[model samples]
Target chain A: MITDRIAVDIKVPNQTRYLCLIGHIGENIARTLRNYSGDREKLAYDLNLVLTEAMANAIQHANEGDPDKEVHIEISIISQRLIIRVFDFGEGFDFKQYVRPGHPLDEHGRGIYLMHSIMDEISYQQTESGHVLKMIKDL
Target chain B: MNLQIEDKGAAVLMAVQEERLDAHNSGELKNHMLKLFEEGKNNLVVDLQAVRFVDSSGLGALVSGFKNASSRNGNLKLSGLQLQVKSMFELTRLHRVFEIYTDSDEALASFQQ
Candidate 1:
């Protein structure tokens, strides 16, 4: 495992169009990890999914789909672990209150569930300026 | 949001041409499916061979289409899911809800049977 930490921070307007681009960036970054022992493709997919989901939530729900606002994303690899943080300047919600939808036919409410399932640790914190969602996965 | 629409007699085949189906464009797919349902073409075989990734919004659009089809006594099936996209369905336990096939031909054939 590489001992040096690597990190990338990005800021983008709160727009859905950037979701795919940011997701691909996350996937490419995961693909570059030299010490990750898990399936590289799977890791790439997970990172992409989590990043997309997190960004979507920040852009849509937290930012209230306000294109004027901006969302911040930070991805870091440290000690064989991948950590992701997404920040949005809006009122935060309780992450613990969300659970997987029980109905198979439900058309929504799966983003947070997927993020929790894919990441080892997930939390939402309120900062002085905004809210941040943190997700960590052991690589 | 490019989709190739074909009338297969038994069902309609809508092939998504995008590689990623997420919050950005899932709304368009949902709107297209709703429009098809309004046109009385409910039984659908959505070909996702080109969709390499699908997030919750994309899944939600498919679920919305599935619900709309079921309400009309029709069906909405999926075909040609990439490994990552398939994993999303499985992860959400939606694989059990939607009839999935290896390809569009098989999905359309199932509609005939």
Candidate 2:
């Protein structure tokens, strides 16, 4: 029940160009928490990869590559847990029904799968504003 | 996206000279690979030793290039996958789709076989 904690809050326009910034943010957060628990490089790598995938999904699929739209990112380190929430004002899909088809050559669907693989916990929900993706990792 | 194209006699070794291969620059890689494919250079090997990170968009570019090469009766191979890239391939079971090698030489040698 650790509330009232906000480490980072950012809102970027739904442009692919901003994806790199999100990766850097994730890396910086991991670096800042290097003294706690997990391997620093691995943590940074996972955070960067997961955040990039999540942001890309929001920019490309949720926002539909609309540069005018906005993607909100919230990072919180609550009780030694790193939590990230990405909000998009777009149509949300049924994440439970989606499965990674056995097409190794296919390109698009790997984003969600990678997010799930890297993060400790992942879920999608529809909020009053839009769709929100929540990912958590233990620090 | 930094790329280095080397003519390896029977195969072409295209090494990614960047640290990241994510959505921001994956389109560049895709376009470059397609350009090479259109030039009748189909036997391709993508060296990822220098690439420390690759997101789904990057993976998509490689797959698109693979499909393009396949349509041209040429094959695309992968070599020098760093741990992170290899993990992504394994996570998505893409290791079954692409011909992955330990090194560019091995990948180029496989083109002969």
Clashing residue pairs found in predicted model 1? none
Position A82, candidate 1: lDDT: 83
Cα deviation at B39, candidate 2, in Å, is 1.9
DockQ of structure 2: 0.77
Provide the lDDT at B109 for model 1.
99
- Show where candidate 2 strays beyond 4 Å: A1-6, A99-102
Give the winner by TM-score.
1
The weakest ten consecutive residues by lDDT in model 2 chain A span: A94-103
What is each predicted model's overall lDDT from 0 to 1? 0.91, 0.85
lDDT of 1 at B51: 94
Candidate 2, residues A16-50, lDDT tens digits: the string is: 88888899888877787634656787778888888
Clashing pairs in 2: none
